[model samples]
Target: MRWRARVKQLLLVGIGTAIGFNGVAVAVAPGRMQTAYGIDDPTPDLTVLLRHRAVMLALIGAVVVVSAWRPPLRPTARVVAAVSMTSFVLFAFGTGVNAAQQRVAIADMVLLVALATATALPDEPRPAARP
Candidate 1:
């Protein structure tokens, strides 16, 4: 495989780890907001938000893993991964603008940008479609 492909493979692995680990963390420990994120009464909102996040992250991780394992559907998986990354940006940026989640917002922006970039590389065509 080309060096570029290797790089993408590593990036996919990294992002997959990020997504899966973060998913489990948010689900199991949506910790105190005042200390962690500076948000008050974070539990209720965090519950709903983390649940959504966990689902998205789990899906994103699956996409990354699948893409890295095989070229087939990699393009479409990349697009879906990009959408997931973009969704993080949407919430994070909005939180930063209106809700003052500065750190998480910035982090989310950076991670999303990285994931999107990693997934944008060219890949072989997907395997033959089934009926």
Candidate 2:
């Protein structure tokens, strides 16, 4: 049981790191859009939107990472991560993604599985209630 909980925490942290890094990359280099999503010659308006999105992802990733060590935050963090990944996967498929986007969708699918696994394992036991 202890081992299982440790594994779950590790998985959550790893997943969070991946997500956070991706956001950081985009935030630092908006040009990553060209390689990551195959967007060519994005307008200034699009760049603004992309940067905003990067910030959102960063926030979500931070929550997931922090939740690993803060049991109280796990549920909300899990829900947020799920919604973010699921929406991207559904949207990419529903609208027909290019190769680059398809790769991202695939990665999200894998992350979803990892998320499910982490969710399945029990976290730390709560303290006993006061009399």
Cα RMSD to native, each candidate?
Answer: 4.9, 1.9
Clashing pairs in 1: none
Models 1 onward score TM values of 0.66, 0.93
Best by TM-score: 2
TM-score of 1: 0.66
For candidate 2, the C-alpha RMSD (Å) to the true structure equals 1.9
Please identify model 1 stretches exceeding 4 Å from their true place.
32-49, 95-100, 124-131
Residues 42-113, model 1: lDDT tens digits: 567667886577667777777777778777756776677667767766776765543445665566666667
TM-score of 2: 0.93
